[model samples]
Target chain A: MNQKLFFTTNILILTTIAFVSIISDIGAKNYTYKQVNASDPWARATSKLAKTGAVYIKNIHNKGKNAVKITGFSANIAKKVQLHNTVVKNEVAKMQHIEFLEIGPNKSVQFNPGGLHIMLMGLKRPLEKNSHFPLIIKFEKLGNLEIMVDIKNIGWSQKKPSNYKHVHH
Target chain B: MKKIIYSILIILVFSALSFGVFFISDHYAQKWQSNKLFKAKLYDVNGKTWSIKSLKDKLGIIYFGYTFCPDACPTALNNLTIALEKIDSKKLQFEPIFISVDPNRDKPKIIKDYLSSFDTIILGLTGTDRDLKSFTFNIGATYSLSREDPEDENYLVNHTVGFFMITSKGASLPIPYRNNPEDLARAIEQIKSIQMSNSKFKKISSIF
Candidate 1:
């Protein structure tokens, strides 16, 4: 009877250890949003004639100890997503596509109108005012984080609408 | 023979004086000419003829952008709108205009609807493809359509991103695109100051 008890105790110990290690392993590989955060995510409402959309996030900060890289992005409303930085030289403005963006530890990157932004092409539908949608931000080291983006009223580009209610995801 | 030579000399002197006068006048012609922004042919949102010249006796503000632009156009226009709003009631009235470079996609109605979304009454205008090109080029602005085919609808337009201010007398004050409203408002004030100085100079030079 004592041998049977000892065998059972050993099996339980081994199983517990295995389960704990599996969880820790998964956590290390996929920290998800715990490593980074996107704040003040918003987009302007698109007109019916608009074929593309743009998403602006106030800042993306790497909250973790290590740097994080953003590899890809997608929106529920767009068939394709690209990172674009609008550059102005000698009064001429153009948008340049960016493939990856890295955020160092304790550092943040900003996205705004007329600057760096996520461009959504082949929009499935026009983004309406006061509407919110989901966008998946893929990380190089960490996993993807789905962020909710609020759409502002048309032409509310310079000032955040006074009635804007930020819905945190 | 002496009489003939004297007559020839007098005639030559008069001709030279007239030629010098004509050359001086030709050299200063363009300096007093009107702004190209005021002379360019464009159709307004109502399909009626429009130009910066119509804003006579008032300040003229114009910007080159497409209504379909997702990011830059709205931001710049908004900055313009806010800056215009900051101008005091005592200040002379101004007409703010938006010229669409995307003639293929941006129609009069589309531009009208787009301008309605903004706070102020921004006059939206467009023209034929060739006309648009020449208008922008002559006005010292540059723009290009991304796709070879504008019917693609998904194309983008890269344009000179900023607002141009003109005094009532047609002196141009071009301000580059900046996201700050304060900077824009300050530029607007500069335009007025420039106009003030311009009229003051004109009054003093009128005696000449």
Candidate 2:
């Protein structure tokens, strides 16, 4: 009888974990996570001297019928990760922290450099090229979705200045 | 009554025309004022006094930003480095100068450490309040820093995006910041050609 109870309790916990409705950092102790369908999610490689970094995602679409709110984000690499949007007025750039980001159904949001970005503060160490770190994106109703952000080479989004004729020594 | 109303309407139209003229002239004045900033004294992080005048015949690119800026500054610097590298012609002498508007937190040592992330050699400069004001005002670059308290270490600074490409004659062309490295490289070449023609014209005039 005890064995049966134990088996049922383990099944319930598994079900809860599988749903992934629990909060980040406490629930879903396992490393297994569902992938967030995002496009070109990457962070720029940083020098060792840098204490802050920025992350970019080309597009994040809300497939659900209802609107979803990205309440917060957590990263293991940085001390803090905040949603930030840069507004340029009369050539002046101002970065503002967003309390939360909402995505309407069938709509997409872009996180790009010099615009919407994920600002990583108090970086524990420099982010290297081709490396990746796990980022937990918390949603109000969708729960926590974990995504791996790859660190691309600096200026990867930009084109080469010109075809190298080797004039620049 | 008719005469008085006509005079008032005439006066209103004259005042409106003058206001429009002033606005147009003021905008052009700021663009032309960069030549005067060529003489502005810039104190580099190395405790060296430098000026656009000292750069002489080279194209000088000036960017005003703080070391603590996270998104725009780094991306601008990276893109600039690429553009410079692509335009690496021995005939086209160019120098990239980064001016720190937030000198309170961005000391010489801090600025040095921050600039090391890029591949190119950039001269990091900061100045006293008076000196900075003269240069920034003449160039029309604006910046503001907000702090919770005077002792607040983590503060955000809002600054103008883009770098001013100063030609050999001190005439500046403002290039807005974006992901277009090709545009930057092309602009640099265009400036070089214009400078070349100006020099050629100068030499011919001297012969006369």
Candidate 3:
């Protein structure tokens, strides 16, 4: 009976240790970063003399408990990468610099034309369509995510209205 | 049945009254916003003096932006270029004018170089701070300059994003156009309609 009791105690202690280790492994993971899904990354092509352009991405945070903040961005094509928001007030469109963009858990943030975007300043060369470039996005919690931005033509986001008809004189 | 009829009657009367009020207010608002042309002297890319009165006989599309603008101005200008290319210039005498809000950075040479990337026909104009203020304010356009350092060459100027259509009579039509082919086409149609009506009115008056 004594030997049996000792055997039972050892098994119980081993099981507890295994369970705790599993829990700790999950807890140590970078949960906030794992939940961030970025897609549809694109940049507008600039002219030869143009030194700046913008990049857009659709960021979706899957985690429902914590918000993810985009802290910084880096691209080889530009000398400076800054997060910007286009604010339209009283018919005037103003581009304002933002420190970070926070997306709530289970929410999405679309960076598109006439809205929030990543400004790429001092471009080394003009962005050409069908060409891709690497963009590293740093997050407050998720760390850094490397994304490939597809270069598109100017006014790529503008779609003709369905009711539009050609005007002829 | 009588109560329901009374409620229906009251709602109808209120709806009509509200529609009438909105229509009248909109009419006055449009009148207040239109037909006011401010005169200013601006320098073109060729260093020629371009007065506001010079645009009187032509249908003008005035755009307020800077040369250093990365996305918005270039995209807008490109769209204008495409739209102008589509239209027959002989049918409608329209001109696209790009006015620089950042006069400090957008000099004549800079404007000329910047505009060369887009349509060469686009007339690039710039003016002094005093000249821009009088012109922009009268046209209901606004822009702000943000400089982190006083001497920093890398600064941002946030200005209005769209284009304003000026009628041949030099009156602003109050409707702004986005950098889209459809919007430009629509504005052209409206201008043609106005031109037609004005010519008809002139003919009738001449007959009298």
Q: How much of the real interface does each model capture, measured as fnat? A: 0.59, 0.63, 0.40
Which parts of model 1 are misplaced by more than 4 Å?
Answer: A1-32, A154-169, B1-39, B88-92, B148-152, B167-170, B199-208
Residue pairs in steric clash, candidate 2? Answer: none
What clash count does candidate 1 reach?
0
i-RMS for every candidate (Å) is 1.9, 1.7, 2.6
* Model 2 CA lDDT for position B19: 71
Best by lDDT: 1
When candidate 3 is compared with the true two-chain complex, its DockQ is 0.23
DockQ of prediction 1: 0.38
Off by over 4 Å in 2: A1-36, A158-169, B1-40, B89-91, B167-169, B190-208
Q: Every model's Cα RMSD, please?
A: 11.7, 13.2, 15.9
- Across B1-208, the per-residue lDDT of candidate 3 in tens digits comes to 9999999999999998897676667555544444334346689998998765667666777889987676567767877777777774452567789999999878898788777656437888988888787777767787889887999776899787767766544455434555466687676667657765865654454432
DockQ of every predicted complex: 0.38, 0.40, 0.23
The model with the greater DockQ, 1 or 2, is 2
- Model 1 residue B140 CA deviation (Å) reads 1.9
Better of 1 and 2 by lDDT: 1
Poorest lDDT segment (10 consecutive residues) of candidate 3 chain B: B30-39
The order by descending DockQ is 2, 1, 3
Q: In model 2, how large is the Cα lDDT of residue A101? A: 85
lDDT scores for all predictions? 0.77, 0.74, 0.72
